[model samples]
Each structure stands twice: as structure tokens, then as C-alpha cells.
Target chain A: MLNRPASDTQITHARRLWLYAVAVLVMAFLILPTFVVIPMSFSDSRFLRFPPQGFSLRWYESYLTSPEWMQATWVSLKVAVLTTLLATPLGIAASYGLHVSRVPFSRVLTIALISPLIIPIIILGVGIFYLYVRLGVVNTIPGLVMAHTILAIPFVVVTVSSGLQQYDSNQELAARNLGASRWTAFRTITLPQIRGSIVAGGLFAFITSFDEVVIALFISGGQNTTLTRRMFTGLRDEIDPTIAAISSLLIVLSVIMLLILVLSNRQK
Target chain B: MSKLSVRSQPIAIRDVTKTYGSFNALENVTLDIAAGEFLTLLGPSGSGKTTLLMVLAGFTRATSGHVLVGSQDMTRVPPHKRDFGMVFQNYALFPHMNVFGNVAYPLRLRRVSRSEIDTRVARALDLVQLSHLAERPIDALSGGQRQRIALARAIVFEPRVLLMDEPLSALDKNLREQMQIEIRNLHENLGITTVYVTHDQREALTMSDQVVVIDAGRISQKGAPREIYERPANAFVADFIGESTLLPVQAGADGFAFGGRALRATVAPPGGLFLVARPEKMELHRTDMDPAYNLFEGTLHQLVYQGETVLAQVALPEGQTISMRLTSRREVMAALPEPGKPITLALHPEDTVIVPERGQ
Candidate 1:
């Protein structure tokens, strides 16, 4: 006969096994969709039907050769680059001012500065649509770029602020004590410490603006359509297998960018 | 300015007061530091030691005071304009820069020639004995090594004065003691008037030419180390500066008395008093036979062997206990007193400092 306590231990072990099974199931739940899209992108078919009869790189080739897709891709790259350039320095300056200000309502000021992040993107899209229209920026590349930068600035602020938190304020003072001007202290001592955060923030802003579709939909139309907008249009007009191909390529690009970020940070 | 015996010395702060809202961080403080004096602002936490240092360094502004270096008023000067060197509590070495670059930074900002900057950086590194590791990244250095690097960087510019805020407080006991002597030696060699801040009384006493004791944002006492330790102005200074076993005593026209035993005192009675005694000053005997002045009959309550010294807790008949430190090895070698053994302890009247029992 099995000992009574031994049986109880077996039951407890079985319950733990069940719990582990559930946890693994939940983990799979989150990762399933991302993996599923990869194989579906390789399908040699007219539609995005999974478990394809064969696999081919025909759709990838199709995207590569298409002038419209190429143009949209270039536009997205240009916008992401412009947004990063415009957002990073502005965000850093704004954060520096907010950090150093001896104002009574500093907390209120920070909240107000970062309110763009809290407001719904849909509302931002609507507001930008009307404003851009009034400013005669509709369907213009510069207008779309400016709109994307506004969306990206908050991420830059938050990330750069985190970097500034680890910085030694006294180090700047030490610089000043050595006969450097205030600006010189800031440039020599203050800037180098938080450069990582600033770069990281720039990368984030780039990606946000690049992959953005909502504001692009509102402000950009016709010839100025972004790659994301093009992809959305492609999906709506037809169940294009090219969407899967384009998405797969975008995912690879994102992974590569993420690797660069991780590698640079690690090297630091 | 002359290299030695300049017309004006290092620094002078006159009636400096710093306030945060209604709380005074430092109040009406004045001090003059000689060109080569190694002065320490020593106090416990919240004692405005750091505040005063910051004010002098130009990182902090005083609400109502004037700070002068040489003949120039520096009260309105910003830190960078004042041209002082400083070491922070956490070392604060630039993590991104290698050791050589960190030491060379201030020189670069001053627009020194590149070759001179390199020469000075190497010399600074040599001064800290870190020349071999000049190219190593800051994160590669150990805590003690990083601390030395910070010191090297601060001095690379050859500032007229150096300020340090608890630079060794983060180090372990052994490293802190070692760095203390190293820093003291550095100060003597360079003859750069330095202001050091710390709360460790032992560090202050060991390292400084003069020690200023602060409490609650005010200077409670300031003197040479021996003077501050031996003649603290009030009960706070006396108790805070060193370990003291204070006993409740009555000082009347006759003499001082505690626990029904009359004791000798140096000064005539001003009022009721609390006598402060250093444990090391009290002598102990095994048997209760003492005709010496300021002697009391007691029982041995506890014995603690503390490496270099043995601590004895003696109990009077009234159940009051006082600790006595005995440094004699022969005393411990003999039969140690068991708990409750009758004993006698003697204290010199001169060593018994009488303080008023106000705010006890």
C-alpha cells in the first residue's frame, strides 16, 4: 500500500504539473500570432491562406519590383529620419529646462509637457487633420513629417529624462569649478552621461514615426501616402499576399534595428 | 597670486546663511581658512556640513552672506566661474570616459594646450598612483581606485582650493582609513587649502588641522582637534564628539555626589549637574577598598573583552551601571571578575566634565 503522505505528495506534484502546463499555455498564447504570420507570408498562393500548397519568394520579389511600394518605403524612411532629427534635441532641451527650473509648479509643468503621450492618438489624428488642412499642409511630406515628430517627442522626453536621472549634477558643478562656463559644463560633463538615453530615445521616436498609420491616414493622402498607409490600402483593396511579404520584411527590419539598439547599449 | 604666503589666503566666509523655505540649512556662519589649512566641517547628519561646503564651492547660494577667495567676493559667483575643484560623495567619475580622459577633461575645458593637458593628466594619475591604469574605463576600476581617480580629476586643473563632500563615507572601514591618510598626505604635499566634510568624528579628529562641529545648521564648536574633543562647549558637543557615560549628579556647595557617594570635582558648583566620564578614564579594582578621591564602591555586573580593551560594567548599590575600559593585559590574564563580584572604581576629578542637565 502507498503511504498516505506519499500519496499526498503525489497529488501536490500533480497539481504543480498542472499549474506549469497552464503557464506554458499562456506563454504560447502571446507568441502564437507573431510566429503564425511568418509561415503564412511564405505561402505560394493568391490569398493569405495558411498551410500553403507550396512556398515561394514570389510575393517578396513582387514588392521589391513595385515602384509604388518602393516609393512609399523611401518616404517612411525619410519621415522617420526627419522626425528623429527634429525630436531628439528639442526633447532634450525641453527636459533640461524642466529639470533645472526652480519653478513652483514644476510637477504641473512636466505633466503638461508630457500630456501629448496621455491623450488618445485618435484625438491627436483628428486635431492634426484640421490643423494641417488649415496650414495648407495636406498631402505634403513636410506636414506629415512635422505631425510624426510631435507624436515622437514625448518618447524622447521620457527616455532622455531617465538617462538624466543617473547623471551627477555635481560633476557639472565640478566642471564649472574648473573655470568652464555653464554651457561648457553642460557640453563636457552633462551631455556625455545621457547620450545613451538620447540615442535610445531617438531610435524609439524613429520607429514610432516610421510605423505610424493613424496620423498618417488623417494628414497624408494621395501621392504622400506612407508605407503603412500603402499596406493598409493594399489589404483593403484586395487580400494581397504582398501585404504578408511586406509585413515580413518590416518585421525583419524592426528586429535588425532592435539588435542594433541592444548591441550599442551593451557595448556602452 | 604668489605661490606661497599670498597677500590673501584661500577663503573667508562671513555671516553666511542658507534657508530652504523656513528651514535654515546654515545660519550666520563665518570662517577663515588659511592657504594650506586642511579644515574639516565635521558633524552628524542634518548638521549643515554639506550645505556650508556647497555654499563655499559656489554650487549653492547663501541667502545672506559673503564668500571671498583671496580679495575677490564670490557670493554671486557660479561654481564654474569660481574655479574650485571638488570630489563628490559617490566619486561621480564620468562613466563614459576612460581614466585619462576624465583627468584631462577640466584641462580641455580651460583650453590648455593638448600636450600640456596630457602631461598634467599623466602627472595627476601618477599622484594618485593610477598611472598604469590611465587608459582603463571608469567602470573597470574598483571602488577605491575610482575614488582616487575622482580625486585626480578634481586636482588636474590645479584649482586654488579643493572641496570634498564625505568622499570616503561610501568606502568600507579599511579603505576609508587608508584613503584618509592618503588624502591627508596629498593635502600636505600640495598645500591647496581644502575643505572636507564628514560626520565621522574620528576621521575629523585624525585628519583636520581644525575641526568645526555643526548641529542643527549652526556651528556649535570650532577648534583644533584636541581642543574640540577635550573641551566641547556644551552637552551636545561633548556627547556627540566622543563616547561618554554621563551620570546624574548633584553639585551643591559641599561637592559633587552620585549614587550616595561624594566625589571630587574641579569646579565649584554652579547648579545641579550631570557629570560626563570617558570609560577609559575610570580605573577598576577587584575588591571594594578605595580611599582615592572620586572613588566609588560597586559590584562587577558584566565583562566584555573587546580585542584591544576589556569593558567592565560596574553596578552601584542603587542599580545604576557605569562602564569602565581597562587596557591592561595582565588584569585579564589573572582571574577575571565573575558577575556580582564586589569591586571599586576610581575616576580623576579633572577628567569628570560637569555639564548642565538641560534638555536631558
Candidate 2:
């Protein structure tokens, strides 16, 4: 009898240990490539390698000093920031409207807004490229911004809608009954409560626009080439280590944006 | 903060009806709330009391009706323009704001001066006795404190009419009782026309100057608290207001007859009727008690001890039962008989009310 209870406890402990081991392995597998890129960026050789024979900062210097790389980086930054500004408010408005509309077909509208995420990115890229070429707006900054905005809007809508779901709309009604106008109630009461979600949605929009390459490759070129498009060409045309350096920088930028999103969420 | 002049306006609801598809939430309801009067709408769940309150607040539109605030037609007006203060069921305080900020929101909407907002908010908090916690975050306060904050916010602007929808329903028994007294006192001091909604019958009887009983989208009865409790209009009101035994009776040549025995009543119904017997107004007797009282011989079935009083269930002839409440005094407890023992009970004829049988 003693042996039976002892073996049962031992079995439970062993099962837990095995479960933790599998979880650690899964996590490591997911994050291993991200960590591998950091060391490869600092490799002295022109080609990507692991366990580098030597270390140097030539790739970083090349990415920083080259005018073509600098222009691409600037273009990407501008588009991401503008996309964030344009999409956050629009998404918040759409979410609030859908929540209060009580229309019979609101579910259909929500599915339509989220369709961009489900549709193949290449098909969307080709379709938009054709439209932009016909309008003579190809290779323009405005065209790039418009394409990126469309891709980022779904993320904003989804995040803002979930945030609004946790909100008590009765607070808005209470404000209105106390003599505040409808717009004033929304601005003062509802907006501040959901500020964290709005900030998180804007960050997601920025990241989506920044990382977008498929649409950028199809529509953007010459003076307004996005960083991702340039990186794609650099990989295809030349075996430049500068791409690794840019990848490392992009990874760091994403971590910083995610950290801001987490901190804003904690504040709420 | 000094006392400021605040005008009160009477509300007139005329033939209000609200329907959703084929179901009616409210049907042809008309009520007039006098200026500075405290009125309560009492009903069970889904009885349309809350719908009536929402209509007055302009949150829910009526299918066909006219709502007038004083001399103005407020039927088509939006809620924000109606300028009525409302306390929600959940207290609905903004979680992002402090006590002072929440209480000062309505004042800020009117573009009041900054210094004036501070003074008025402080005074409102003082009225609710939470002046010391004016700077506290909303999450830090207890449920009762949040309710008080909601009350202070609703009254800070001193709107013409104040509406409350089950504001104390979330509180525990003791706190709810305490808040009811505090709210009634506040209403007396402010003298603002107020409309309150609650399903608790005791709360309605305690806090209302006028109690309106609503049932199934219609007004069952409307009167003072005493009139509603002592003289309920029908079987529904009597069964709803308090514990009572409603016995079917028939009109005899001399008086009313229940189970072929003559029973005296203060009021006579035209056709079928029910004799409403309040538990507390009943007395238990052994020998001849009084000739003026209506007497019924029965067997004692059970005695339910309820702290200070005992509920005695008496089984009469023909399988009918009536409950009598006796105080837990020494003499009363000693005189109580065992279960299945024969006993006689006396009920005053004046305490027996004859209300018409429903649907006839």
C-alpha cells in the first residue's frame, strides 16, 4: 500500500516534468531564428554564418551610411507613422458605430472588414498594383500609404472592438443624461477608458505597415521604395550582409513597440 | 459651498406605449409626477416599471405617446437635451476618474468656472458624506460608496427631475436599509421631483410619497404607501405587497360566505370576491374571545420561528389553510398548541377586505 501511494506521487511529478520540458522546447523552437539573426548580423564574412570566425561592424556601418538604405528606411518610417494616425481613429469610430448600430447585418460588415487578413496577400498586391498603374499613381508615396492603410485597418478594428466590448456603454448614457452632448460624452468618458486599446491598435497598425513587403514590392519603386522592398531586392540581387543588420534593427524596433503596447495596457 | 437656487419641474406622461414587434413592453400608461414629489414605480421583473422610467429619461422612445416636462414637449427631445439626472442600476461611475472628477462632470459640460466646479463638487461629496474621499479613485471605493458617488453626481447639476433605477439593489440588506433612509432624507432636503424604480416592496413602501404598482405593462394601482399596503386594489396587489391569505368567498343574502359559513367584511364586491386576511391582524383563541370578530376553528399545522415572531399555519376545514403571525412573547409561546391540535382563531371584520376576483 505504501509503495502504491509513493509510485502514484512519483508518476504525477514525472508527468509534470515531461510537460514542462516539451513546453520549453516549443518556445525555443519559435524564438531560435530571431536569436540566430542577431549574431549573423555581426559576422565579419559577407555571407550569413553561425558561430562566426570573427566579428565586425561593417554591415551596420554600410546600412547606416548608404544613401539608398537611408532613403528606404525613411520611406518605411513615414508610411508606418501615417498609417497609424489614419487607421486608429477610423478603426475606433467603426468599432463604436458597429457596437451601437443594432443593425441586422452588422455581422456581415464585421466579416467584410476582416477579409483582408484572410485573403491571400499576393492576390491583393496584384489587384492593387493593377488599379494603381491605371490611375498613374504607381511608385508614389501616397499610393504606398493607401495600400499600407488598407492592410493595417483590420488589425486596428479587431483590437479596438475587443477593447470596446469591455466598456460599459451605460456610462455614456449616464453622461448624456447629465447634460453632456453625445460627442462630448464619447470624447470625455468613453475615449479615455479605451485609450489603452487605441494605443495598442495604433502600434499594431504601425508594425503591420512597417513589415509589409508583398504590396510594397508590387506598387513601390524608385524614390519611394519601402525598406522591406529594398531588403527583398538586396537579398535577390546581392548577398549583402547589410540585410542582416537591417533585420536586427527591425527586430529591436518591434520589441520596443510591443513593450509600449504592454505598458499602456497595464496602465489601463 | 452655499445653497444655490434650483428649479424643479413636474413631468406628465400621456398615453405612453412601447412595443417591440408583437410584444408590448408598456401599454397606454399615463402618470403625472408632481414637482418635488417622490414617486416610486414598484413591480416584479419584466413588469415595465423600468421601461416607464427610461421613457421619462428619454433613453427609450415610446411607440405613441407624449412626454411633457413642465410646459415643454419633450417627447422628441434627445436625452442629453432633456437635462434630467439619472442614477443607473450599476452606479455607472467612470472608472478613469476620481471622485471629484466624476461629480464635477456635469458641471464641466456646462462650462462652469474651474473654481466653481471644485466648490460644487466638494459640496456634493459632503452631502453624501464622502467629502474626505473626494480624491480617491473609483476602484478604491466600496459598492455603497460608489452608489453614493453616483447619487452625488446626479444631483450636483441640480436638474429638474432625478431618476433612479434600482440604485440600492446591489447592496446587502443592512446597507440597503441604511441607504434608503439616507436617500429619502436627501430628497426631503433637496425637494427635487424624483422618480424611483424598485422591485422590493418594502423599499417602495418606505421611500415613496406615492407608490405606483405596475403589472404586465400596465398600472395596477397608484396611491400613498399606507393606502397601497392597507387597501390594495386587487388580488395581485395584495399578494404582491405583503404576506396575506386570499380566500375565495361568495356573496350571501346577509354578507359574504366562505365554505358555507357567514363572514363579515367592511367592503362588498358585486359578484365573486376574495377576503384578504393579513397575518399580523389575526388572533388565536381557545374559548369564546369576542362576538364581534369572525371566528374559524382549525387544527394547528406548523409553527415557523422567525426570530421575533412565529408564523402559525392553521389548517381549516375543506383543506384550506391560513397563516397567523404571533409575537414570540412568553405568554404567546406558552399558549401555542402542538401540531394537529384543535384551535380557534379570531380575525377582526374591519381588517378583512373584500377585493373583486381578478378577470371577472
The 10-residue segment with the lowest total lDDT in model 1 chain A: A1-10
lDDT of 1 by residue, B155-243 (tens): 88887788999999899999999999999988877888889999999999999999988888888878899878765666677789787
Candidate 2 lDDT for residue B252: 77
| Model 1 Cα lDDT, one tens digit per residue, A149-184 | 888888888988888887778676666776678898
Q: What lDDT is reached at residue A25 by model 1?
A: 96
After superposition, candidate 1 runs with Cα above 4 Å error: A1-75, A94-119, A134-136, A162-182, A234-249, B1-8, B248-273, B284-300, B316-320, B331-344, B356-360
For candidate 1, the clash count comes to: 1
Clashing pairs in 2: none
Error of 2 at A104 (Å): 3.2
* Top candidate when judged by lDDT against the true structure: 2
Residue B141's lDDT within candidate 2 is 97
For model 1, the docking class works out as medium
